[model samples]
Target: MTLSIDNLQQMEIEYIKMFSEVSEDEQTLTFNNSNIPDMYTHNFDLYKSDVGLLEYIESQINKVETKAKGFFRIETYHPISADLIEKLSVKPQICTYDFMGIETRNYINLIGNPECSVLSAESSRVLEDGITVDIAVNEEGMGLDFATRRIKGKAEVYKNPDKAIELFVCYSGDTPIGNIEYIPFNRVAKFEDFDILEDYQRRSFGTSVLKHLLEKAFDNNIEHAYLITDQADTAKEMYKKNGFEKVGEKTELLFLF
Candidate 1:
């Protein structure tokens, strides 16, 4: 059985909320990074309908083990009986164990706040950089209202706010052009880590702003930072220039039965 994108998205949303709830007690449980994009489950029936979802989970668990650090183990919880299984024992894949699986997915890389040097010379050299931007942290209702118009002309993705800190940025003229939506991760213990997005990409505006943000993160006592980028994106080099190392990977898997 194949799941529609809408159904997949809905499942993801539910899982995000579930992870958020889990984070309330244990701050380490979040679903925004690498292979576990946002697989939330409000209705187990949806997953049950798909015979191969369990295999997908198993593959993801193995993949995560190879690519990420900090988590000791992954488990699946059955809501009704409060039963937890360390490894999904079901075999949804019909084939024999004759081949290995490889895939990729969209995810955000997280890092603890850490101090690092980013070349401010690039932003200063860009004569097109003319806007004065100011970022406001966690003042959602009003700040978003003030920043929405600026964001209208740009790109954005919202992380799970409950497990992470929320940020809102505005310009001096009440026009916001860029934003960084992120969560608090303690793994990269020396860096105040975040994912940055800008409405405009030409002038190194977003990169410049991110440099400042990292500076602030360092001031707050952070050491390392990480972010997940599409394999096609060249900006990975920028992250490297700023002192982040590629510590893990996430792949997407599609299941059809």
Candidate 2:
């Protein structure tokens, strides 16, 4: 299968549509997940950067803010122009996400730790231990207070049987050390929300979980697997080392009220 920027973008949109209430217009696609009011799950995704569409994006965001609490975000497939940036009332923190993909055929024999085991999570409730541990270890200051709301919101969408999503918890011995989400569509699989506890980092647990995900993809005859990571994140290097390559990038504009 040939990997292209268009294919990566479409795959991402399909993944979002799985759990989000998506509404499309000529200018943008609005994704609203009332279940999870997180910035990523709820946003206005512009098909292209156009100064004329700025007002419509702002109006939609305003509508979302009134119904859903917390921050609002806008994603652009193309880079925002100076005119669009300068017109915003509040200066937004712009973020760039690199879309990475790989042909699983090239890595069918990849290996990792034999002791690390990946198990499918039947429900989000079962992921609490791993989520709690991961948050407590990775986040600063914010602990269970943050985890509670996040888990509650995620639980709404995680358990939906209609979605092609699968949640997995990685265990080392009897301890839950990490977790990841897998979504496969039309022979293309997406891996997201991958995290390992601080104490579990540097060991082979993270790699083992990734290897397990790829092996699952291969078993299902999936030709490609992909993930999105912040441009500054170090994890992209690890992904590249395995089999993934940078295929494209998307820009996110975030506004906090």
The sequence of per-residue lDDT tens digits that candidate 1 reaches over residues 50-168 is: 23434545554455542353222222211212122234443222211111111111012323223222222113221111112322322253365444433221211222334343343
Cα lDDT, model 1, residue 40: 19
Q: In order, what lDDT does every prediction score?
A: 0.33, 0.74
User: How much is 98 displaced in model 2, in angstroms?
Assistant: 0.3
Give lDDT tens digits, candidate 2, residues 1-257: 77676677777788788667888877777787766555354445545544465785567557765436556677777767778879876567888999888887666556667789888888555567656655665467445655666655565567788778878888888888888889998788889888887777767788788888888898899988888999999877878777788888888887666
Off by over 4 Å in 2: 38-40, 48-70, 123-130, 133-143
Q: Which residue window of length 10 is worst by lDDT in model 1?
A: 97-106
Clash pairs, model 2 backbone: none
